[model samples]
Target: MKPQHLLAAATLVLATTAFAAGDPHDHAHAHTPLHGGVVVEVKDIDYELVAQPSVIQLHLRDHGKPADVSNATARLTLLTGTEKQEVVLKPAGDKLEATGSFKVAPGSKAVAVVTVAGKPSTVRFVLK
Candidate 1:
């Protein structure tokens, strides 16, 4: 084969390999919760939050396994129409939970600020 043709083929092969290596095809945001809650991802960590009429719970997982949040603190903000309320969540076993009467409707939206090891991350959810 000609040297120029060989060089072109090698360049194509290298480019393809590099592109495949950098491709984010893992679908990181497509997480199905084990507890049937709303799931969101932050920094590759999955947070599943369940909202009820008078209670809220947050479950943290790392790669589908339960994660410990004993050293973490969380605050939840709920918005419905023009009213907004916030609640503080304390670590409870394998999850973070809070008890308070809340107004959660079909169009309500929630934002959770989770602080683990002193670093804070936010997750948002809009109810269907």
Candidate 2:
């Protein structure tokens, strides 16, 4: 195409990215959860943050094995940028919920040490 058309297209793309980057309304799909185990990934997790029951702040997966996380004995390592904290995890219904303690600050990274049956396991979650 012409140079002017190319410039206009480039300008349009930059404008769109800038708009998406700076606007809070563009927070679509940001609330989606990321479920993974055996490897740490940056995704939303379905773990509760402390005992709020309203906010879950943990990352874990069943791994589809009876030998993995079958008994539920885990610890959630919370990291708020520079600050670090730990939350105990217990079997709450079908999910592993943090025990009554601290409210997991939003946007904090979480690393978990889960002990299932008699085996120790690990997983990490990057805050949504």
Candidate 3:
């Protein structure tokens, strides 16, 4: 085989191996939200954040089963441009609920800190 042909084949093998090793879009998966909100997975738990004008709700599901939030406590930070607000959430049945006058704009972001059974977890969401 020619030297140039051998080099080209070696380069092709390396490029193929590198592409197969890592995929940048591996995290992009189809997730259907049970509640009408943004869902993020944290520590094998799926947390759905529903933010309205004056109410914020966090719903949790474990492997498609509703997880209890009865003894869980949560704090939500809302960021809209230069404005920032925080809300504390308490257990309300199967989910955590917080009510306040929050400015959740289109480009806003939300970070949730939840402690369930004394274990802390964090979830993040970008408002649409």
Worst 10 residues of 2 by lDDT: 36-45
- The pairs that clash in candidate 1 are none
**lDDT agreement with native, every candidate:** 0.87, 0.53, 0.87
Ten-residue stretch with the least lDDT total in model 1: 23-32
Q: Point out the higher-scoring one by lDDT: 2 or 3.
A: 3
Assess the local accuracy of residue 40 in candidate 3 as a C-alpha lDDT between 0 and 100. 86
Query: Please, what are the lDDT tens digits per residue for candidate 2 over residues 18-107?
Result: 987894443333332344222332222223223232444343433321122336787777777787777777665555665454534456
Task: State model 3's lDDT.
Answer: 0.87
TM-score of 1: 0.76
lDDT tens string, model 1, 1-128?
A: 99999999999999999988993546654588777688887877889988888878999987677887999999889999999998999999999999879888877999999999899999998776
Question: Which residue runs of candidate 1 sit more than 4 Å off their true CA positions?
Answer: 1-30
Answer with 1 or 2, whichever has the higher TM-score.
1
Give candidate 2 regions above 4 Å deviation.
1-70, 99-106
lDDT of 3 by residue, 36-77 (tens): 888888877889988899989999988678898899999888
